[model samples]
Target: MPICVYWGEDDFAIEKAVALLRDRVLDPMWTSFNYTSFPPEQADAAIQGLNQVMTPTFGAGGRLVWLINNTLCQHCPDNVLAELLRTLPIIPENSFLLLTSRNKPDERLKSTKLLKQFATEFREFPLIPPWKTELLVQSVNQAALAADVKLTSKTAQLLAESVGNDTRLLYNEIEKLRLYAEGSNKPLDVATVTQLVRNTTQNSLQLAAAIRTGDTAKALGTLADLINASEPGLRIIATLIGQFRTWLWVKIMIESGERNQQAIASAADIGNPKRIYFLQQEIKFLSVEQLISCLPLLLELEISLKQGASEITILQTKVIELCQICRGS
Candidate 1:
């Protein structure tokens, strides 16, 4: 009865842990029969997963019932959660239940408390702060190992800085680097990673920075590159909107006398407290009102894109308008 609870903001880590656990416990040949997965936000996910856990394994390997969102902590009704608490401990000896969430478990929920106590292995994979360069370096190094490639610490640090806190993107870039260096028998160097990795996350940040600094040309160039790369228009708008929301949060928190980075991070639900420092700097030139105004502009852009507007042209026009707004023109 190997019961595990994996939760945190690092979804990539949670996903990998799930796969690793599945490989370790479930027999590949019998996986189709014994392994089950439940995604988040499904109304019956908790009960369905619980039902699967009750079923005995049909073959030699152990059974695995994985619940990805684990809504019991937040959305499940009290009676249903009580039922889960009652049923969870009785899972067959050969069965395993793995519950994962991208958000921290709400301690106020009875189900979370029950699972915390009953789970044999509880692991948390919180987002590493961007300013924690060493953690980022270690993360990249670890990723390289999982990818069966070598990366110099400096190269790893560079890659970490380039990708920010996105584990999935970091891993993807590492794989690309491995492929690029496959024949050369060379450990990835800074120059090689710089040459090969596109760093779309960085590009997004750059676009935001450019817009804020009134660098119209740079903003337009970054927008064109993103558009040409076929990044979805709505996704781009969403990213900007999210950033703006964060900026607004920072502004409000600071105005309310919240100077502590950790406090700001908590308010914004930002994984890394150190990121608050960068957010502080980024939002320095803007106001809460300005950030609020930007949201509607972005929403309008999103609506226009969905209404069959020209994505490139709409994005171009919005970026220019935002730049002017940022410049107070």
Candidate 2:
């Protein structure tokens, strides 16, 4: 019950969780003496952490040994695993061992299995994909509830669209809205969220939509807005690749005579089977060939961005090409 494992792509959420755990486990007066952290760069951090967690508390509080950005879950050397096997069961009840990582622990790994058996808690803070609007809206609502801010359903949806999958921005915006709602009797409305939250509606998803519709002008415009907003070019390409890949999968499944929405959803990695209906409608005008063609262009765009080409120029050129492909021109 003294071992905890937290791994995920949502770094801000992980950091907040860690802070809460630190507060719960360590006495403020004795924190400096009792809390030991091994950053990823520290040599033999996992083994060192295992050793540290076995030590008795220094003062009046429980000891907490943290292995930050740990890779043991992904690949633990036999020696480290041996140490964990020896130390974990005997760790003092007054001491806690915490391992955190950005990568998911491989369930097949012996180290991960051992940690699962001993860990009191194992949690993942995965980032929601941008295309998953329903999940994003739900996350926004939950965050608003936590921040003690009231928001209309429309306002929650608006905030979700504005912030997308950025948990840090979502929390900061919710905090700002909470402060503004001090003594206000009404729930925050869409107008209020639109006024306060940075309007990032012109995101990569919007760019993808513009391309789907063969609107070269709109696609170019959205690309400009994203670049102007300082959105990373590689991130933009990544989103495009994911979006296009999903579309391609859906198209392939439908064209292959797969009628079951759940099957199509599963094939495309879509969470909601109902969403397949909407996606089918969106891509009805395009053939599988067109969707297939977008992938190479997207790959080229990604390569150009990585090679230090001008972001705006390369993005704009690729956007035009994608629009043409969708347009059958």
Candidate 3:
């Protein structure tokens, strides 16, 4: 693949793809002379990488010029885009240009148009939707296999639920599990997952669910678990604020007759449309006014924490207050 494009939202997958390309293209002995990686944010990265990729290899094998997070087809300045369009078509067979982006390229751009000619070499690694549990489990199993660890199907499912769809975090958790099970022949099980994985984000979601349902005790318990686990005070507040804000947005949109799940998910930035069903159920008992009021109160809690108030006290007080408000007391 002379002009390889590995664009994706999943940084881990993008990185693995890039590394594989490097191994396939560049000779290890001549890597210093053959491999160049350009971060698109750097000054003149587009022109520099294009010029570099066209330069022939010094000694033996193929050369690779990687533009990680390249935005040439979308945000590159005019000069750089012009230079890229001029240079891309003439790239040597032995010299490869590898472009990766966090987003899909703008199809209308000339650079994107030219690249479409080589669509077979273009790869995309979008994040798995929230409802794709099977894909997530497969990902974890693959990571474990690479690390020479055995992750059972049931355990992988449990782990995927805890980690959600963050590939970087999933890989990190798999490595941790690998080390944990190094000497034992037994595979990683749900019991070990319960003991080791922090799953702070999921806990925060559970906190939101507890609050939405007016279960003060459960809310307090989840919050306490989070606090005891050394989760940051501001992070907890931020999560609650985000959840409540999402609820408010979805509620208002529903009232406005936005019945499409995809539209609701996109509007609320929810990764999984299926969660909208659960969100609908959770907020069924609460009013729009209640959801609307959450952010300001959470902001106050945040300020109190920053001003040296005990986190436990502020968090517990806010949880109780919200629970009361949610119960219409």
Ranking by lDDT: 2, 3, 1
- Give the worst 10-residue stretch by lDDT in candidate 2: 192-201
Model 1: lDDT of residue 313: 88
Assess candidate 3 and give its TM-score to the true structure: 0.67
lDDT values of the candidates?
0.80, 0.90, 0.80
**Residue-by-residue lDDT tens digits, candidate 2, 218-239:** 8888988998888889878888
Clashing residue pairs in all predictions, respectively, total 0, 0, 0
Per-residue error for 207 in candidate 3, Å, reads 2.0
- Model 3 lDDT at residue 154: 81
Estimate, for each residue in 1-329, the C-alpha lDDT of model 3 and write its tens digit. Answer: 37887777788888888888899988889999999988857888878988998898988889999887878667666787678678877888889888888988888887787777753488889876444455667777888889887877788878887776678888888888888988988887778887887672455667877888788998999898878867678767866787788888889888888999999988988777887887787688788898877778888998998899998988999999888778782
Candidate 3: list runs displaced more than 4 Å.
127-135, 145-148, 152-154, 182-185, 198-202, 217-329
Give the TM-scores of the predictions, in the order they appear: 0.65, 0.89, 0.67
- Provide the lDDT at 139 for model 1: 84
